[model samples]
Target: MVLAWNGADPSEVGDGSNYELGVWYRAEVDITITHLRIWTGPGEINVTNRRGRIWSSGGGALAVITLPDNPGDGWTLHALTAPLQIDSGTTFLPSYSTGGNYGALPNALNANVPSADGNLVALSAANSPTGFNGTFNTDPETFPNSGFGAPFYGVDFQYTLGHGDATPPRIVDTSAIADGLQVTAAAVVEDDEDLTGLTLRIDWGDGTDATTVTYPTLQASHTYATSGIYPLLFRATDSSGETANRADFVQVFGADASSNRLNTKAMQQALASHAMVLGNFKTVSLHEPRVRPAEPLHVALWWSTITPIDASGLAVTSARVEWLLRMYTPGEQEPQDEMDAIIGDATDRLIGSLARDFDLDDHVVDGLVRMIDIRGAHGARLNAVAGWARWSDGMSRVVTVTIPVIVNDVWQEGAA
Candidate 1:
């Protein structure tokens, strides 16, 4: 999926301009690029020494391939020596140099191009500081950032759905319970590829041997000798050996104590569903739908991968989770009050000890809670946005969810 435009012939063809012409674009998801393509003009046939290149937004060459000397007068594709992985939400440039006429369509990239696999948006002056269509010296192959008008220079790339099996399996919709001396855990596990050899491991966190099971069977039970609070761990491994881990806190009540005090039944029912998904990697659920002006809001965020994202061997170093809260008058566009927090580095000062690390050691089906001081009038609405960002790249991937909250000094039944 990432293509500059549809496979239609351009309406205009430029005379042999010995310059590199291409499009600057961004992908909505991670993709593995295997080939580069260029729309050749009728006169471009038999042209020799045609070269194509993929460049980073910062002007670094990523991959270069030579087109066939006798490419047909249509879309010409050249496979790279190896597949190149492109991170989601990052910009890149794909260009080709030919001392022959090139096909083009004016103002074609003013908006996103249509693709079946993934979203590909052309960068323009309106949407991007780097602009969209561009040209540069053909011989030296410098980054193409000079053109304008959002023209389609016919440069494109072919990519697969994701970074292959580079991504680990996702563990979502998890539920755990510890009643009396027996503990039970379950999760919905999935991977980018087949789960033929996937395995789920459960550690009761009570100094006992962990329980292991295969895919399609995620539920595990363990019996403890004493009644207490125990940490439960769940780990899933795909065929590629990539693994994802999750944790939960289980409480076992003594004989005289009532298990109903913990409300395990209601918590388990809630864990079966999620309120929303953030950045396609984290699932979120609201724990407290209604809160007072000065009270705190609680939400549970379950990540598909380990916290402090391990984007090693990629473009960035580290990543952090962030959240933003906005309160507004019933139907107003402007916010009356707002609060935000970042849950990685710089967390200590951002929210003043409210930034809690993801409970990888113990997930009590709790929320990442933060106090919100609503200054808006009564009957205000609340919306929450959360996402993750790369520390080095500064590119954020976010998602927004609207959760109803009633902020008032007087408690009223059915008042929204």
Candidate 2:
């Protein structure tokens, strides 16, 4: 299920001084649970890994405030979720307070919530006199991006329980596969949480690529403009953003009374297990673990194998993926020569030590994986660093490079 939080103001505020979210501001909240049967008083909600809470004011109202400065969560600042529990068939109208937790509470939204509606249920507001707005850059807003300038009672991602249907994708029906144009697609998309991106593999019968949608479930059909019984495949992403290959949707084109039946119906092998390495941007040291002068920067490597492979013996083959170096803005003098030296050293290390035997296409999930650190030799540069990722042997090639980054001073990425 998709949860969206948006920011706005009440009609009563004429000066628009409300919800500016200055240094601090408490918020009114209304929460609804769809397709579930559960109820309880949520003491607190999590936000940005921080925690916040709502409580009953002396005037039969709910009050929200940031956790103690110490927050007891072992963090100076936390990402918290606001949990304003509303009872069954009851509307909860929460008001903001002029105080944090110790002072008097004042509400911005008139505390007239209609909770008694049989179809209506839970609601509460967790606010601090302090504002909980987060900064933002330009992008047509979308889910995953928490609302700007406001907190949804401090919540990130939450899945409604039992909102998923345990079903893999299937190709229930389709029209005849054609020579120049053949269409194949999923028979249905169903889920408990809620269906998400659904993808279908389409083979145009020629050597052209197997058409695929990185994000599926949104489209209903795929057309191939070439001839051949391109083995078609199917994969569906679940509400929680998990993906699964639906081999049941495998089909073939060019199948007739002339060809061998099995060969005519080759499954979309391309829709095999997939893997993705998660990446994040964080503040880190420029030396030691990741980047080192005149040494290969050994970065933490992780991956989710999409296709199943017996990597018991496959060695990881790597190439000079990325070679980069960046420091603060400089003067008229350039550091090009220093950068060339740093990158040149990194290339030597990659050519010698990188794993050279493995089938990346058949990567097994949680199977044998490799990790290396960029370290220095006897006497190396103190601050220069270079890094790279393993590459496939011109086979199973996706992007041009494994560590698709190279050159020092080319990126501001201090951490990989």
Give the best candidate by lDDT: 1
TM-score of 1: 0.38
Residue range 1-416, candidate 1, lDDT tens digits: 23444534565375756778767777787777767877776677676777789988888899998888767777755767787888989888888886767777777767666554446566654565474454455553666667657677778776656776345788886777766778788988876544555789987766899999987788988888765556556789865467987755565656644331222232222221221112111222323223222212223333121123332234322222222322211121123223233222122222221222212113223321111222212222233345433334233222333322111111222434
The TM-score obtained by model 2 is: 0.28
- Candidate 2 residue 205 C-alpha distance from true site, Å: 8.1
Clashing pairs in 1: none
> Which sections of candidate 1 miss by over 4 Å?
1-4, 136-140, 165-416
For model 2, the run of ten residues with the poorest summed lDDT: 275-284
lDDT of 2 at 136: 17
Candidate 1 — worst ten consecutive residues by lDDT sum?
Answer: 272-281
- lDDT at position 152, candidate 1: 74
Tally clashes: model 1.
Answer: 0
Counting clashing residue pairs in each candidate, in order, gives 0, 64
Give lDDT for model 1. 0.54
